[model samples]
Target: MLWFLTCVAALIGGYFLYGAFIEKVFGIKVDRQTPAHTKTDGVDYVPMSTPKVYLVQLLNIAGVGPIFGPIMGALYGPAAMLWIVLGCVFAGAVHDYFSGMLSVRNGGASVPSITGKYLGNGAKHFMNVFAIVLLLLVGVVFVSAPASMLTNLMNDQFNLGITMTAMVVIIFAYYIIATIVPVDKIIGRFYPLFGGLLIFMSVGLISAIAISSDHSVLGGYEPSQMFTNMNPNDLPLWPALFITIACGAISGFHATQSPLMARCMENEKNGRFVFYGAMIGEGIIALIWCAIALSFFDGMEALQAAVANGGPGNVVYSSAFGLLGTFGGIIAFLGVVILPITSGDTAFRSSRLILAEYFNMEQKTLRNRLLMALPLFVIGGILTQVDFGIIWRYFGFANQTTAVMMLWTATAYLVRHNKLHWITTVPAVFMTSVCITFILNNSQLGFGLPMTLSTITGVVSAVAIAALVIIKSRNSGEVDSEEESLQS
Candidate 1:
């Protein structure tokens, strides 16, 4: 009961507090700034109410990744939960908060556009390629994991022979919705509805579980089970931690979502509410997931067995519902479907925006955007046909790597803009160090260290050099005209 209350309190408290600050400090009047281009149509560029914007942003940002990442991260035991919560605040929330504000101030540009201004054309092109590849990887994995869950549910309930039926249904549903609902309308209504459902289900499940289970319920498991159950090479804390934090801590995907939400902000003040508020809400959700996993699984072996027998989705769902009755299970099952849909919508919309910007094409027509989004849908569908669990692991690794890049970029921006306070530096150094330590320990874990240590070291060194160069350029009064404008 206490745990459940803490989760709710954290969410509510964080939302209002952040909302207040953004309004007070940024004076974020939504109507003061117009979108860069006035090609506004009801489909893609419709304005939204503050409440609706908040809801959609929350749903788009929170997803199955938060639930799963924290659970798997628990392999480092309960201690890791501290990192998840704290990291989100200092590293993740800050990234989202500033990224959104920066985009809005710059006429709703994506991460690449922002990078281009500060990092030069070569870096801009690099970021664009990296962002697209990361998006596809994340999109496919997100779609597949939930589809796999639905497939197992169908097989268990109806003895269906089709292993891929669930995946088909998911893709079909997403396509149908994307075609029918304008991106704006989806964000206005469905996003919040989905977010509300997640909170309700999470609270209900946690409360039910806490009420029913005693301390003795999961005693057979030990803390070391998390590390020992996996190949020693695969279980290194630092590498896994780095990977987990990337997906949960900070994500490039958030960069896409931020600009969309920024366009809807009634005032610049609302940026804090919509951006930072959503992040804090996500962090609370992460904590709840960690609590659930720690409460249910006895050790790593048990978690692995469950995953092997039923897959990760089934293991998570079954455990969540284990403490409750059939009613609880049904609620959890529904939440799983909602999870992927919300994320898919966000990804689809973001991908469309990227394409529009990349090709200098207008997004005035629904047909054109849908045509552009078809490739993403197809790729997600094909990925669903493969081993989802393995795909998810790789996605995790990629997520962390991208986060390091983003944090590096954001840190550079802060330093150049003269906003490099102690708060920023501490979290920046913490996350950067976490990534470096993970890379160093990769050899000891025997995970086949695909990328060489020297190469990783060189990359880190290069980022440091780039940061220095940017600082020197600013000091020497040689900053780019656009970057100077952005800071002012």
Candidate 2:
């Protein structure tokens, strides 16, 4: 209980303390004109109030990642909690703030463009394909998961006889509409409502846990089991836990989502509140779910059995219905549905922007938006036909790998300015190690190398990359001159 409360407080405190420090390091300009005003395309680059942007940004990144990822991570015991709190504060929020602000600095450029600007053209080329495919995977994964859930709920409750296929089509159609419309049209207006449902559901769950008669509701903090790797499958704790809990801790996927809001933000000052604050909000949701999962089913053994039976979705359903009752269950169900749909839409939208930026095509006209969006949706629609279970497994690693790249990009940005580069440098190297080690050790992804060899190789590779980046930054040019010029 003490550990749980401390984690919660740390996340909140981290925001005011560390979040402010990051803002100072990035050097926010209150009077600077944002892309929303300078670019003003009416389609994507539209100025929005701080509150609306924050809510939209929150929902955009808050998909099932936090809820589902943390639940899965809970299988690894309280070590998951430590990762979530620390990772969100130090790694995730910083990555998000810089990704968004960098885009703002570069006229709301996509992640690939921003990466290319700092990391060079090779990275830009790689991220072009890498980011789009990742977005497509995110779109498809969110589509299938929610379609299945909505199908079950509707068929069970209203006997609507809605098949998953039909739901997929309906969702795809909505995604198309959401992808092409102006920022203020559907997403901007309705997302606050969706965000409301999400917050309501989270609050209800927290209340249920608080008032429960069971003394074990927050009982995962037993010092004996706090740091233990309690996975039923005996999975190694290092890379797997990090990958499994990406969003609650840190996710590269948020890098893709941040630019959408970056283009919409009216001021640089709001970047911390929207980007860092939203990630913290996600951490809170993840913390709640992880704590509940630890004690909801009597013990770690029972939690394992429940998860094994039906995955995290089952756990989400059981907890909502079991604790919050029928009405709250329905709301929780809608929140679940809203989470992925919101993200999937933005996934497609972000892809459209990426393609537009790649080709130097203007998107002011409907035809241009359609031209960019149609092919991507066609490919996405086709992918819906294939089973994603195997492909989705790679997303965890891919997502973190993207984060590693973004972190390195931010590290380079700080290094170029001759500021304290360690803020992003440490996390960048750490995540680089996690990604390299995970792929090598996991049979499904890489060579299935021995764990010891993989760990040693990952650490060595990360250190080599860090040293290389530092040397390159020193030789690149007069960073001090560039910094002064930018300030002027």
Candidate 3:
């Protein structure tokens, strides 16, 4: 409980302190015209209130990743708390802030374009394909996971006899409408309510923990526990914990989602509150879920068995229903359901935007919007038919790899301007190591090297890349004319 409170405090402090420094570093132009005004098309680029943009961005980057990922990461003990707090403050929020701000600075370009601008044309071409694939997989995963949950919830709770296939069709239909419609129409209007539910769920669960009579079960942090390998499977903490806790800690996927809100932001001044603040909000959710998971099952042994038996979904449902009571639990359950659905809609919407930008297609016409969106859905719909279990394993790596690219890109941006570059460069190198070690150590993913060798290679490779980026940035000329104009 002491550790949990401290982590929560640190996340909030991070927003005010470190987040402000990032905003200053980016040099927010208060009077500058944002893309929302310059590129307003009443569809993707409409200006929105800061509150709405913040909530939408919150729901966008956050899916089930915060909840499920932390629940899984909790298997590692207090070390999970360490990652969530430090990683969110230093790595995740900074990454998110830059991703959105850079997009805002570049007429709401997608990750591929942003990376391409900094990393080069080759990177641009690669990220175009890489980002689209990641978004599609996210779209499909969100669709299937939520559809199945709704199907079971309706069946078991209300006996509505809703089939998963029917639910999938319903979700996909919503995704299409959400994808093709104007920003202010469906997503802009409804996402705040969904975001409210998410907050309500988090607050209610935390209140439950606070009021519980038994404090011992909630467990305070211990120094010795930090080094203890509490994972039931004896998984190493270095790479496995980092990958498992991506969303709550630092995820590359957030970079893909940032541009959506980047287009809607009315002012550069609100960047910190919207982008970095949203990541902090997500870190809070992740912390609550982790704490609850650590204490909910009586012991780590039972928690592991339960997770193995029914997966994180079962654990979430059971915990919410048990702690929140019938009425509160129902609302909380709906919140969980909303997480993926909201993210799924935005995932598809982002895909459309990225594709439109990639092809230089005009999205002003409803016909153009449909043309870009229809194919993505068709591909996504077909992908829903593949073995999801197989595809999901690759997503973690792809997600982090994209993050690495964005971090390096942000580093390059700073270096080109002759400002602080280490802020991004350090995390960039760290996550590069995490991704490399993960793939190398996992048998199905890489060469199945031993953990020590994988760690060594991962660290060495990341350092080498960092050195090259620093040297190249020193040799690199100036910020592009377009970028200078945007910043000015």
**TM-score of predicted structure 1:** 0.83
Over 1-488, each residue of candidate 3 has an lDDT whose tens digit, in order, gives: 77788889999999999999988888988898888988889999999999999999999988988988898998998678789999999999999999999999888888898888788888899999999999998898898888877887888788999888999999999999998889999989999989889989999888887787653335654668865779988878878888888889888889999999999999999999999999999999999989888877777887788788767888888888888877888899889889989999998888898899888898988999999999999999999998766656677778888889999999988888888999999999999999999998899878889999999999999999998888887787574843442322
Q: lDDT by residue for model 2 over 342-408, one digit each (tens)?
A: 9999999999999998998889999999999999999988888887666568778888989999999
Where is the poorest 10-residue window by lDDT in model 2?
479-488
Task: Give a tens-digit lDDT track for model 1, residues 76-129.
Answer: 555555566556665677678766776766667777777666556776787777
Model 2: pairs clashing at backbone N, Cα or C within 3 Å: none
TM-score of each: 0.83, 0.96, 0.97
How far in Å is the alpha carbon of 233 misplaced in model 2?
A: 2.0
The positional error of residue 113 in candidate 2, measured at the CA in angstroms, is 0.6
Name the runs in model 3 displaced over 4 angstroms.
214-217, 220-223, 482-488
Question: Where does candidate 1 have its weakest 10-residue lDDT segment?
Answer: 478-487
Segments of candidate 2 deviating more than 4 angstroms: 478-488
Better by TM-score, candidate 2 or 1: 2
